[model samples]
Target: MEASSNFLKRSGFLTLLMIFVLCCSKEVNIPEPVQAYEPHTSKIREILFIGNSFTSFNLGISYHLNLYLANDSLSYKPLIQEAAFSGYSLAVHLTNEQTLAKLNERSWDVIILQENTDIAVNDTMATLESIKAFQELVGNKGTLIYLLMSWPYKDQPEMLIPIIKTFEEGSQAIGATIIPVGEVWTAINQDGNPNIDLYNADGMHPSLQGTFLAASMCYSHIYNQNPSENPYLAGLENTTALYLKQKAN
Candidate 1:
């Protein structure tokens, strides 16, 4: 009887030991999500920015783009290449040496041009002249895209609505693409989501969420991604990729 009891205890201990060993052997740990990336060259040859405080946006939009480039795990990081700044219009920046330096530095891959939200008002000619003058300096190889920055005027979308055609005209004339963030915001605003705050304290500049939306849109277009479906723009990417591919052929 004692031998039988000893055998049972020994078996039980072995079973427990096997369980412990199995537990220690390995755990099916899911890998962490890989850091975001794009299939672009390691060095960002050049990029230039011209726009309003909206384009500058507490500089959040620009910084977020840089962050996306810097954090990418690929061997090559997307560098700034070059940058220029102006408020409200391109007129000031185009005249400045900084704009020339940025343009002259390299055959830029992209040039970001943005106009003030109130282009329907005064000094729009100044904005247009800047774009025209800068285009002369902007080398032929780079793709220019007009950033259609959205206003945070959640209450008065009407005041902000007229700028759409202005952006489209800029895009058509300059052979540039439009970011169309205003369209995105207009659609979102129409949904009447009470939970989302689209504007900053002044009710003009986008808040963080608005910035995220803009950044996501920029990210989507630049990387050939979509913003809505894939959660952080997974679905949008494929659609753009396919579209670009089809267009190329």
Candidate 2:
């Protein structure tokens, strides 16, 4: 009877070990998880511009960007949506229901924001508040936001100091990136570049050359590509285009 009991216990233990080994040895086919598409790629598909004439002037930001990209022989062509109104402040956009609605209208890869040129200097708090609100509204939607730091008035170059400060504060507060267009203009001016005039007759809006520079900056930021390689001239002389593109890069 003792021998039979020992035999039974040994048999049971062997069976259990065999079962565990069998279970562990078999390959379990867990499907590899599908990767989500990233929006920030070498090929940016959609962009939403939210601002005033600073973004839409001189045949529009969209036009110049597309022209540059297409001329560069890129595989992807971007679809740009502009929600810009001339002379509108960030406060106006905050109160405008249409602007809020437009945020949900599409899946934008990038949303570029340009405030009224003077608002950042004159009313920094209001500008910062609106930027914060917009950033919150657009942040979670999987879109990158960029602040276009426009140039100060031509006559009042001193205004740039405060304006740059305001944009810096606003961008830090909201975690948005800034495209330093104003800084670029300042550099060109301080360097004594005789060929580049970035402003229109109003001294606020950009000239065709200014728009080209702005567009190149936008393109570079969005696509992660160098702007100098682009072939689109935007009617600018080759030397001027090359200079602007180099600065934009």
Candidate 3:
């Protein structure tokens, strides 16, 4: 009788312990599954611009591009970001920690690389090497790489020849698309619109019109659509904006 009673007590305790454990488990909250970090929604296209002052001047190309996109009735939205600094070349970017961090921050849909104007003209080999390095880093992420061709100085029109050649060679060597911004600027110059000035007083940096033109060209090539179609004037006069869009198209 004593053994049977002890057995029953032990069984009762064991059952009680299990019940307590089960109750505790039911009361405790289990965490939901962790999701990966996504910077933008699937409906948004992210573009990262890596360049120098030419890219950042006048609030940057991405700024105007966003303005154009915002005014359009497109299916997908665009989110543009930049890691541009004054006088920073592709070679300099490779060595800079901040630039490296920005490059690896996210899987961008498109990465636009603009080399320093002087490096592209004088050191084509270096430019190609930097482009190759960037290509390797980008890998097969389905990200499109493009070179934003820099325009010639306002006073030195002859510089455009070598600059164009360098960008062409770099694009061909790396299998990247060329934005041809410089070419567009050259065409605009030939058009002889005194109302449109592409260069800042320094003759190196781009003026507001130059930046608008660059942004328009970028919009045209990146979207495979005509910039003239987009009604965003980017704060410019209607006639001037229309003229720039026509040239970009």
For candidate 1, give the lDDT.
Answer: 0.59
Question: Model 3: per-residue lDDT, tens digit, 1-249?
Answer: 999999999999999999999988786677999864322223438999999999999999999988877777556767799999999999999999998898888887889999999998899999999999998888777778999999888887888999989999988987899999898898888989878988999988999999999999888888766777677887899999999999888
On residues 1-249, what C-alpha lDDT tens digit does candidate 2 reach at each position? 999999999999999999999999999999999875333346457888889988889978878887766665546666887888888888898778887788788878888889898788889998989888877777777888889998988888998998899999988987888999999888887877888888899888899998999999988877776777667788889999999999999
Model 3, TM vs. native: 0.80
Q: How much lDDT does candidate 3 score?
A: 0.88
lDDT of 1 by residue, 39-87 (tens): 3443443455556566666455666656544544446645443243434
TM-score, predicted candidate 1 vs. hidden true structure? 0.66
Off by over 4 Å in 1: 1-45, 81-86, 120-126, 141-143, 227-249
Per-residue error for 181 in candidate 3, Å, reads 1.1
* TM-scores of the models, in the order given: 0.66, 0.79, 0.80
Better model by TM-score, 1 or 2?
A: 2
RMSD of 2: 15.1
lDDT of each: 0.59, 0.84, 0.88
Q: Candidate 2 overall Cα lDDT vs. reference? A: 0.84
- In candidate 1, position 186 carries an lDDT of 71
